[model samples]
Target: MHDLIPFIPGSVNDVLGSLPFFLPEIYLTALFILVLITNLLFGRNSEKLCRIIACAGILLVIQRDYQQIQLLFMSGRLNGQFLFNEMLLLNRTAINFKFIIDALAFVLLLYFGWDNRLKSHPKGLSDLYTIVIGSVLGLHLMAMAVNLLSIYLAIEMVSIASYLMVTYRSENAFGTEAGLKYVLFGAASSAMMLYGISLLYGFTGSLNLFSGNLLPGLIQANPVAVSFSLVLVLVGIGFKLSFVPIHFWVPDVYEGASTPVTAWLSTLPKIAGFALLINFLRPFVYFEKWDGFDFKLALSIIGIITMIAGNFAAIMQRNVKRMLAYSSIGHTGFALMAIVTYNSTGIAALTFYLAVYGLANIGALALATYFANALDADDMNSYKGLGLKYPAASVCFVIVLVSLTGLPISAGFTGKVLVFSSVYGIYQQNHNLWLLLLMITGALTTVVSLFYYIKIPLNLFLKRTEFVKNTLIKSQNIIVLSIIISVLIVLLGVWPDFLFKLF
Candidate 1:
């Protein structure tokens, strides 16, 4: 019986260790099921209940995970490796730093719950909450997934949820059109990615990323084939991230989808997509094992093109959501610079940047939703004179815009500086003139971005336009969350080390 007692405790510890790492997902799963039941049982009034339950579930996970962070760090619990046979491994770096369900997700959840734009839908709110929980769960998994199969499943899960969200208002033509575009593009990309994965698996006979033994034979066999497979895989990731050349669907989709859903779509998928990029590139960083490939060079070229294209395209946009969509593409390019570094500092910087970026984006979208509701407009011209009518929300908008432009005393600036410094460190070590040029171009684009990002404030505050009075139904909860996020952005910009230590 004494020996049995020891075995019982050991089994319990093993189960607890595996379970705690997945707390957020477990909460989400329960919320999804409960919301579905509430929708079926309570009918019309279930929307509010569903929303509250979803928000509560996410909050509970955040609170529990945060309390564990100190312990995780102290015991170096943040640095474990759990392998599910030969296919998947969950590591501390992937969970704590990469799979982070932190302030960013919390802020996004707040935005999702507070945005009244979603209330415009005729269907029960339960459906929206289910999709949100499921999609976010997929995003969290995507960030931690280290195998090709897991990656595909994660992306598809998010993609399907996104399609439903886009077409939620199926009575409208725009919604149907956006859904079709998304489904077609998403399906094609997934097929290509699957084919690429098959090729990779055939060449290497393994899918586990951290094992680091799958690529040598492929690299020696045919460089062109390997590069082709890499490009195919990136195509799927780019579809999710909406990077240049593959970004054709973004503007239309953003304009068509409900604002809150668009906001969620823009932030979460990009973060996970970048995480997957970092995971995919980890083995190739040293180049000692694979001497023939130039993965860094490929990434640098893609980053340059994505940034330039996104910024230039955004400059011509009239719709605010469309412009933000393009701006997201440009930000993806900026984040890629850190990925090019292929080191811990680079990964840490990327993680920090995404968190700040997600918060800023959610705040900006919240303000946009308010403006759309108040003025019934989404064009840049409609923002004229908003500063006078909706002063608080307008001010928040300006601050978010400044942060997006990478201006001083904002989280955006901190993110930019971190990526810049990390890339410079890499450049200094290698003396790579090409990277230096790309960095220079990125800086120049930052200035160019300022012109467009500030156009909202300029339109709102400085321009003289007709006073169009409209109902500005302010949600106190959303406003407070925005203010909090804005303050954090400025605080992190000033004292970045405090934020860096979290990673």
Candidate 2:
């Protein structure tokens, strides 16, 4: 008891010190509460106020994130600092991830009500704004989490928000079904993750990944058990990433959820999941004696399979959103190629690639909303000749899809090149067969992606339809923002330094 007395003041000092680094997330919690209060105070009439508040709050969060970035660079603290008893990390990479997530989230918050179907919800979008704010907080947590307990909690927070967002349109039976599926899959994955965490804690007697006890304990434990536990944890992160076998829930969820919600589901969580994966893998990757799990081989196999499956399956989808869903899976695989490299250059490339991909994806889905509002079109067959009818929307769709396909003069192209170069650089040094296979698979899948992505433009511009049922264009906001995103994509592609310099 006497010895423990000194620890109390130290713990208090740690919590107090963590607050500054945690400013963005603290603001997010307050934002969430503010939005909820606005919702309750004004009921359905709170939509606009909630949106305005949420958007403004996110921008402030982004500003805070920017400041953190400056502090990291200016203070020469490139190695990062630990907080909350080393359960979380405050570092350049984590800060960058939070910045990207918050920046995209600001756009998404503005986008939520732009979807005609979502805008027509009887309960209004106030609840959605609240959920998104909360989720952003969770996403920030995921980026910084260094302890197993924090990781599980952060994931669950975001997962719960996702469930609510997917099922927001409860009147839509399809959406409700998708939400049910998401919850079921999410629960199973969470259980596996928690069990894995339990096993690790039992083995190491510590929750912190970087703690002195973790690696030493794991090195001494049964290798098979350690590997199994690690794989199970990946199961949870994989569910968020929507990669390969864990990806079955993606298409159905994307197709069934509102376009804006699908946009959110595909981008932000996946970006943060990658951040989480990097955090989880870092300690193991750096420990030279640790060979309990071959992360490179496992991730390479997963990447190769994910690329092939996502791109090829996309070719068969007629529904535009569903096709984008598969396309996202393919992108996840491509990003994994960067992760497997496990180097500074690879990490930088991954950050840029994910940012570019996330922007293009949100733009693509926004166009989906645009057409759905303009012509009630959702599938390729229904898209025939609407290109001429709505040339701006069609052109934006083409540009975004071009980026997704990694064609030139688009950011996606630049991103893919960076990731490819990073992997090849690593391959040159190690001559790993897995790296070579990943590069080959990535290239082949890029070509395969063209087949499906091209189908959109072909239907939009080539296939002629004489009859059209058109509606008032209520999706102007979505169109305008998508065009801006498209221009940014091209700009970043042409001058990769615009984004690369940030990293």
* C-alpha local distance difference test of each model: 0.78, 0.92
lDDT of 1 by residue, 1-503 (tens): 67688678766666666665566667768877887888888888887787777777777766755654554666575655443332334554555543354445555655655655667666656787778778877877777677888888989998999898888765368767987988898899999999988888878887766665467767766778887887888899889888777888888888788777778778888888887777677666654677755778877888899899888888998889889988998998888888888788888888888878887887888888877767676888988877877788888888888888899888898889888999999899999976897799789889988878888998999987866765766576766777887788788889988878867
Question: By TM-score, who's the top model here?
Answer: 2
- Tell me each candidate's TM-score: 0.91, 0.98
Clashing pairs in 1: none
Please list the residue runs of candidate 1 whose C-alpha ends up more than 4 Å from where it truly belongs after superposition: 1-20, 67-78, 97-102, 113-117
- Candidate 2 regions off by >4 Å? 1-3, 74-76
Q: How many clashes (backbone atoms < 3 Å, residues ≥3 apart in a chain or on different chains) does model 1 have?
A: 0
**Count of backbone collisions within predicted model 2:** 0
384 in model 2: Cα distance from truth in Å?
0.4
